[model samples]
Target: MEEAIFSKLRYMKKVLLIGGAGFIGFNITKFLAENRNYEITVADNFFRGKMDVLLTDLVDKYKIRVVNADFTNAASFDQLDKDYDQVYMLAAVVGVKYTEEIPNELIRINAFLALNTLEWLKTAQCKKVVFTSTSECYAGTIEAFDYQVPTPESVPLCIDDITHPRFTYAVTKMLGESGFMNYSKVFGFECTIVRYHNVYGPRMGFKHVIPQVTQRFLKKEDPFKIYGYDQTRSFNYIDDAVNGTVLAMETPDVSGEIFHIGDMTDELKIEELIKYIGELMDYKGTYEYESAPSGSVSRRCPDISKAQKMLGYDPKTSWKVGVKNTIEWYVNYINTGGDVFE
Candidate 1:
C-alpha cells in the first residue's frame, strides 16, 4: 500500500461487497443478485453478522460467492480478486454495546478494517466504491454547536469527548471518512459516502433499540424504562437504506460525494418509539425515563435532500409500517423457537 497513485482500473461487470453477511449487506447482496447480472461475492467474518438460513438460501439460489475470513488483517485482501468494478465497503464493528464495553478493541478493529481496505485498494483494480458511514460522525457537531437537526453530509465531523467510551465508534468512522476520501483521491478510485441514520428493520439483530425494546415487551416488563426519552432520531427502514446505497453505487459521475441516507419525515422521540413497540406487543407496562448513557448525542437526524436530488433516492417506508413489519418478524421468530443472538 504505497502513497502513489496507480494505473486506472478497467471497468467490468463484477461487484464485491466486503461485509455482505450483515443485515444491510445481506439485503444489498440480495438486491444485486435479483436485479442485476453482475458476478457477486460476499466477503465477511460474521462476528456480528450471521450466516443464517436466509443468507444460505440466497447463496444457494443465486450461486453467489462467499469468503469467510477475519478482515482485521490486511493480508486477507490477498484472498480476493483485484478486478471488481463496484465495491461496497460495509465492514466495521457497529452497535453501542461494543463501543461501550470494548472501546479499545472496537477502535483497533474498525480503524484497521478501514485502513487495510484502503491499502488493498492501492493495487486492487477496483473501480467506483461506496463507503458506508454513520450519522454519528456528525453527532457531536449537532450536540455541541446546536447544528441543524436534519443534518446533512457537509456538517463537519467531530467527537464530543475523545476520552469517552461511547464516542469511540464515531471516532473510528471519522477516520474512515477521511481515509476513504484521501485514498480515493490519491489512487483515482471513484468514491461516494452515505452516512446512515437510524436504519432498522427485521433481522437488524438484538443490539439495536427496536429489537431490545421488543424483547423487553415480550418478557412482559411491568415498568419499562425508556433510556433517552426526549432524544429524537429518524429511523430508516432497511429496504430504503438498501435502495439509497445501490443508487450511490450505480449513479454516474458522482465521485468524492457524501449523502445522508435516512428518513427525515418521521423523526420521533425515544419514548414515542418504545411506546409504539409496546402497544404493538399489547404490553400494559408503565413507562419511565432514565438518563441516556454518557456521551450520547441529545438529538440526531439526517438531511437527505442531497441524496434525493442527486441519486433519485426516495425512501417510502413510514416508521409505523417499518416497525410493524419488524415487530411481527421478531414475534414469529421467537414464537417458533428460532435461535438469535441477543
Candidate 2:
C-alpha cells in the first residue's frame, strides 16, 4: 500500500505559474488549491504581486511552493523546474498609468519577460502553457476601423497609432500572443491564449476601475466625475475569469486556440457602472460626465460564443452583483486599514 501510494503521488501533475502572485494569479492559485490535487509552484518577482495576508494564508494552507524571483532577467528561469505539466504566463507590466508614465519601461519589461519565457520553454519539458492576454490588443481595431461590438476573436488586431504611448501595452501583448503561439508550435508543446476583458473582483488591487470607484465613493467625493461616460465595457468577475482560464488549461484538443473570456451579457456604459457603484456605496452625490482619456476604446464587449461552445465557458455573475461584492470587499478592506496596492 505504501509503494502504491508513493507511485500515485509521483505521477501527480506539476503546475507552474510564472506570475502567480498577482490578482488573477493568486485567485487561480486558490481555486486550483481548493479544487484540484496538482502540485503547484508560484514564481513571481513581488514587484506588483504582493505577499499579503490572503496569499500567505493560501500558501500556508495548501503548501503551495513560492519562488520569488525577477523573471525579466533570463537567469531567473533557472530557479524553476523544467518538468511542469502545466504553465501559466501571467506576468506583465499592466495599467494605463504605466503606459502614460513609463511606456519605455513597459515595453522593455513585458517584451523581455515574454522572450525569456519562450527561450526557457524551448528547453523545459512542460506539457502545455496558457498565455493571458488582454482585450486592448484589438481595441485599436474597434476604434480605428469601426469594428463590430461583441467583438469576436477573429477580429484583426491593429494599432491605431504606433507612436502613441497608450498602444505600448497592447503592442507587448500582441508580441506575447505571437511569440507564445509560434514558439509552442516549434517547440512541440501545447499552447492556448486567453484574452481577458475587464476582469475585476475583490483584492484585485486599486489600479482597476472598480476599486478606484470604490475608493472615490469611500472618500465621499461630491459630484463624482465619471470619465468615459459614453464608453462601454463588459466586466468579467475574477471568479468567472478563473473558471475560463482553468478550463482553457485542462480541456483537451484545444492547443493553438484563442478564447475571449468575458461576460457578453453584462456590457454597460461607464456612466451606468459609476452610478450603480454610487448607489451601492449609498452615495447621494451629483455626477459630472467627462470625456474618456485619450486612446480609450469607445465601446468594448466580447463575442464569447467561441469560449462557450469550445470550452463551455459561461460567466454567471451579473455586473451589479459583482460590483456589489467588489465594493463591499473594498469598503471593508479600507475600513480595516488595508494598504493600497497596484
Candidate 3:
C-alpha cells in the first residue's frame, strides 16, 4: 500500500468498501459515491445489511457497483474485481448489547473478517485502509458512577476479562485491531483504526436502541422504555462520523495509528435521549427508563481530542438536529410502507 497525498488520489482512483452495503459502510460509500471521485464497489453478503434499504439508484447514477461477497473467506475477497486505492472495512456484528447475546458468533465474524480482508488487501496491494473500530474496546469504566465524563482511549481496556458481559464486544474488536496492526507492521500495509462511539442515524439496525426508540414512538408507544434511564451515552451523529472517516482516510502520516471518532462532550442520559427523539418525531409518549439488560453499561462516551487535533475533526450537528433528521427520514420511510426502518 502506498502513502500518497489526498489530491493525488483523484488521479489514481478506485475504492472498495468491504461492507459498503451495511449501516456505517453505506454512509461512507454514499459520501464517496455521490462525489463520483472514485469508482466505488460495495460488497456485502447481506448477513445484516439489507439491499432493500440501500440507495440502489446511487449505484446507477454514480457508477457505484454492488457485489455480494463474504469477507470471511479469502477466496471470495480475492475474487473481487475492484482495485482499490482506499478500502473502508465497516463490516461487523455491531452493538455491544447485541453482541453480548451472540459472543461466539461475534468473535468469529469480527475476527475472521479482519484476517481475511487484510490478507486480500495485502494481495491486492490496496492502499490506505480505514478500519472502523468501536468505543466498546474500552470495556470497563473506571470512573465513579457520579462522574459524568467521556472515556478516553488511555482508559484501561480490560480485554483479558471477556467474562464480563460488557466486555465481550470490546474484546473481539481489540483482537481485530491487533490483527490489523500486526499485518500493517509485517506487510507495510497502510491502515488506520478509528474507534467509533455510538453512531446513530438513517439505515442503522432497528435492534439498535436509537432506531428502536424511534420505531416505538412511531407506533404510538412510550419510546423511552429502557432499563436504567440514567445510563449515559454519547451519540455520534452520522455526518460527524462520516467526516471523521473521510478525514482519517485523507490524512497523511496516520497509517497504522488509531483515533477515537466521536463527540466526547455530547453525553446524553438514555431517558433524555428518548425524550429528545420523541420531540423530534412530535411523538406524545411517556419517557420511561427501566432496568437495562444484563450487560448494558452504565456509561458510554468517547474522548475525541486525538481526532480533533490530528484529523481537524469536530461534530457539527447538534443532537437535536441529528435526531430531527433521523426522525424525518424514518417517518417518510414509514409513510412509504418501508417496514425495513423497524
lDDT tens digits, residues 1-342, model 1?
332322212222799999899989999999988988678899999987788999999999988999998889988988899989999999988988998789999999999999999999999999989999998898889888889888878798887888888888998989999999999999999999999998898888888888888888999987888897998889999999999999999999789999999999998988899989988999986988899887788888888999999999999999999999999999998889987773
Candidate 3, residues 1-342, lDDT tens digits: the string is 355655667585788887788888888888887664677888888887777726676677787778887778777875675467788888887766556577787778878888888777666777778888887666444432233256665665554355765565677678778888788788776889889888888778677776776778778874447567788888889989999998999899989778888887678888787777777778765665578766556777777888898889989988778878887777777778776632
lDDT of 1 at 45: 97
| Candidate 2: tens digits of C-alpha lDDT, residues 124-162 | 999999999999999999988999999999999998999
What are the models' TM-scores? 0.95, 0.98, 0.89
Q: Where does model 2 exceed 4 Å of error?
A: 1-11
> Where in model 1 is the C-alpha error above 4 Å?
1-12
TM-score: the better of candidates 1 and 3: 1
Q: Rank the candidates by TM-score, best first.
A: 2, 1, 3
Q: In candidate 1, what residue range of length 10 has the lowest lDDT sum?
A: 3-12
Q: Which ten residues in a row have the lowest lDDT in candidate 2?
A: 4-13
Q: List the residue pairs that clash in candidate 1.
A: none
Q: By the lDDT metric, which is better: model 1 or model 3? A: 1
Q: List the lowest-lDDT window of 10 residues for candidate 3.
A: 139-148
